[model samples]
Target: MQIDWVTVAAQIVNFLVLAWLLHRFLYGPITRAMERRENAIRTRIEEAEETREQAEARARELEQERAELNARREEILEEAREEARRLKDRLQQEARAEVDELREAWRAELDEDRNEFLAAMRTEAREGFRTLADDALRALADTTLTERMAEAFAARVGDLDEVDAERLRGAVRRGEGLVITLGSDVSGALRGTLTAAVRKAVGDEVEIDIPESSDDFTGIRLKAGGETLDWTLDAHLDRFADRLASAFPTEDARETQDDDANGGRGAGDSTLGDSHGGTAAGGKGQASDAREGAAGDG
Candidate 1:
């Protein structure tokens, strides 16, 4: 129970020394290491935060790119649709044009065919009529036609226009005479009458000659050197046939014949009607002459 002051004091001093050693060697160094660890952890946390922020920014950029790509795809699709529509319309227009062209060509060909057929029919008709008339007239021909035809032909020379008269004069001048061709021999009286008529029509200086021809045409041919005028029944018939041909000409011939037919003498006014009348009258008269000749021969 009594206090030991030196021992107590020594114990207190040792305890103080131990505390100071721990603070300098162990506690101070441990405290410094803890602070350094704390600082390192803080730096690592800041770097992790920075990395996360960068990742978030990158994600936002990717989303924006995806949106842009979708918009561009839509635009391309619309453009493609418009181009297809344009191409379809162009093709349809071309087909329509081709169809129209073909139709026009077909119509033109049809018209040409029709024109050709009509022309052929007209030609056939003309040829058929000419053949029939020639056969009928030849069958009905008789001897008394000689004088009547000669008289009629001689009178026709007097009725010639200035152009025909001039042509005859030139031909006569060249040949030095006028030649009268007959279908058959005529009586001296008829010959004299025809000779007088020719002298009256032509100049008195002209000579008249009658020649025998083998052709069966019942008409006259007046020739002067190279120029010969056909005033025969065959010629008249040919002219009539020509008129018939002209009246119903083909499509190609109508334009030419229309102008000629309108300007020149028609079938009725020209020698066509007159020639037929003469032929008919001469045939009847020749039939009567045949009866008389037969009676005389008997």
Candidate 2:
């Protein structure tokens, strides 16, 4: 095919003009629309990505919150359990202390009651024994016991200590006469025996006198100058009562009785004469000049 240069040139020029027109109108508008659409899509994609990141952050926060809440719950539960244990132990301790205190109080009460009972029994027994002894001695008053007692008492009087003997001797030298007083119940034989004993103990030439007394005891009392000696059955019995009181004293009276015993030595003590059974030896040799002072009137 032969090429026509002018027609080809003209056709080329027309095509170029048409392409330019399309570019300026249709192509330009289509390209701009497509670019705008692409921009919008990109914007939507970026927004979706930002939303996804925010969701992920929110999920992480929720997960962390849940973990912390779970940890807090566990800790609270453990604390509550420990508190319960401590409370239980405290209550148990209180209960044990209360029981021990109650037991101690009961024991103290029992001991007090026992001591009271024992004291009461001791008092009863002591009273009973004293009554029995008094009755028996009264019944046996007129027996050989009296004679033997009188002899023993006279012997004790004869065995005076050096100090008492000296006192009696000095009193005899100063005094006018010796006085011998006998209990009203004393027998004639006893009076004669006592008179002989006095003469022997004093001196062969010493004065002897026997006087009557309104006492109920079968005892003798001797007076020389200002010195007096009593050896009465009543006195012996009183000494016995004192000994009995000491031996069976109660708690309340023991302190008082102990003080009395320690304060001074009484007659019938174990030192001068043997007073094993409430018997006291009463005698001393002291008489005035050689004159016998008849006791009945003088």
| CA lDDT, every model vs. true structure | 0.65, 0.62
* Top lDDT hit: 1
Lowest lDDT sum, 10 consecutive residues, model 2, at: 285-294
Per-model clash counts, in order, read 0, 1
Per-residue lDDT over 128-157 for candidate 1, one digit per residue giving the tens place of the 0 to 100 score: 544555566566763245555666766766
Compose the digit string of candidate 2's lDDT tens values, residues 72-117: 9999999999999999999999999999788678666755665565
| Segments of candidate 2 deviating more than 4 angstroms | 1-145, 216-218, 234-298
Candidate 1 ranges with C-alpha deviation above 4 Å: 1-70, 139-158, 167-298
Candidate with top TM-score is: 1
Cα displacement (Å) at residue 199, model 1: 12
